[model samples]
Target: MIRVVILGAGNIAQHLYTVFTKSEAIQVVQVYNRSQKALQSFTNVATTTRLKELRDADVYIIAVADDAIASVANKLPFTNRLVVHTSGSASMHVLHKKNRRGVFYPLQTFTKGKEVDFSQIPLCLEAREKTDFKVLQQLADAIGSPSYKISSEQRRALHVSAVFVNNFSNHLYRIAHEICEANNVPFQILHPLIQETAHKITTLTPYMAQTGPAKRGDQKTIDDHLEKLDKDIHKEIYTLLTQSIAKTYGREKL
Candidate 1:
């Protein structure tokens, strides 16, 4: 079995620990955190507050915040071992040069209490050595996740695109929620449209799936939307997105 020591007790770390423990091909030997309190949730595995006391493992997975990853890696007692971090934007080179470095980024937004299906989540991996890449691929396979060998530059681009698709899209949903609230309409009314939009993208390219006034260059409808928006920020967002959509369809004059 592939032995792993997970460092950090945050959402991603907790989720990885849970999934790894369930896989017969992998074993989470220990979990480390800066404090013992965060380590309490990892009931089945060994836990440690002291980095120097970390046991030897085949791979050390640092699932901490992007900023803290380097600090944790630099403090590790040993060197030249396989070490990987779970970050999309942070380059694998951010890990101190003392160890064999790699990335094991899961391309999905993780929530603390929500369970994620590993099979559907994409695992983006990178390694300095080919053998280390295989190890990460094996770990991804053990967790039933699809794996991709991506360079740091490519991963950074993907991270930015992910922000546009996932984070920005979620914020739009929040804005819709606020609009519904102001109008005294149940936000649930938009649930089917939301689901349909997500479902459409699976079968059709986003450009092909695009619809509505902006795509059609319906200036009257666009103006109506901007005028109806109660907040200036909302109006600005509407105008900017509409202009973007219009530009995408070669209707810049609209």
Candidate 2:
């Protein structure tokens, strides 16, 4: 069994602790954070605040913020034991050179206080050495996850694409919410449409599934939508995106 010492007590840490603890092929030997108070959420596992007190383990998984990773890695008591960080945007080189470095970043949006479905999330693995890569892959498989061997360059591309899918998509939902509020319509009415929009991409390419007043070249409808938006900034954004989408479909006027 691969023993893992997780370094962090945040959302990703909690999720990984839960999943890894339940896996038969791996064991969570310890969980460490800078503050002892934050470790209360973990039960039946050794928790510590001092990095010097970290126990021997097959791997030390740093699941902390981007800025704090190096600080934590620098404090590890031993060198050359596998050390990995679970960050999508941060590079693997950020970790201290004292150990076998790798990135075990999970590509997905994490919300505190909400349960995450790890089975649906993709794990991106990167290692400085081949042996470390196999170790990371073994852990991923133990937790019933699909993983991809990605270089720092490909991971950067994935991170940027994720921002467009998760961050930008959430902003669009906020805009939709505001529009619903202005029309005295409950935002719940859009829930089905929003769900369907995401579901459509599973079976159809986004380009082929695109549909709107703009796609149909309905200039009158496009103008009405812009006028209905209460905020000028939102109207501007809507107009720009609509125009861009229309142009892609050879209906530039809309």
Which candidate has the top score in TM-score? 1
Error of 1 at 72 (Å): 0.9
* TM-score, per-candidate, Cα-based: 0.99, 0.95
What does candidate 1 score on TM? 0.99
**In candidate 2, which residue ranges exceed 4 Å CA deviation?**
none
Q: Give the alpha carbon lDDT tens digit for every residue of 11-104 in model 1.
A: 9999999999999999999999998899888997899999999999999999999999999999999999999999999999999999999999
| lDDT (C-alpha) at residue 62 in model 2 | 98
Computed on alpha carbons, the lDDT of every model, listed in order, comes to 0.95, 0.91
lDDT computed for candidate 2? 0.91
Candidate 2 lDDT score at position 113: 80
Weakest ten-residue segment in model 1 by summed lDDT: 219-228
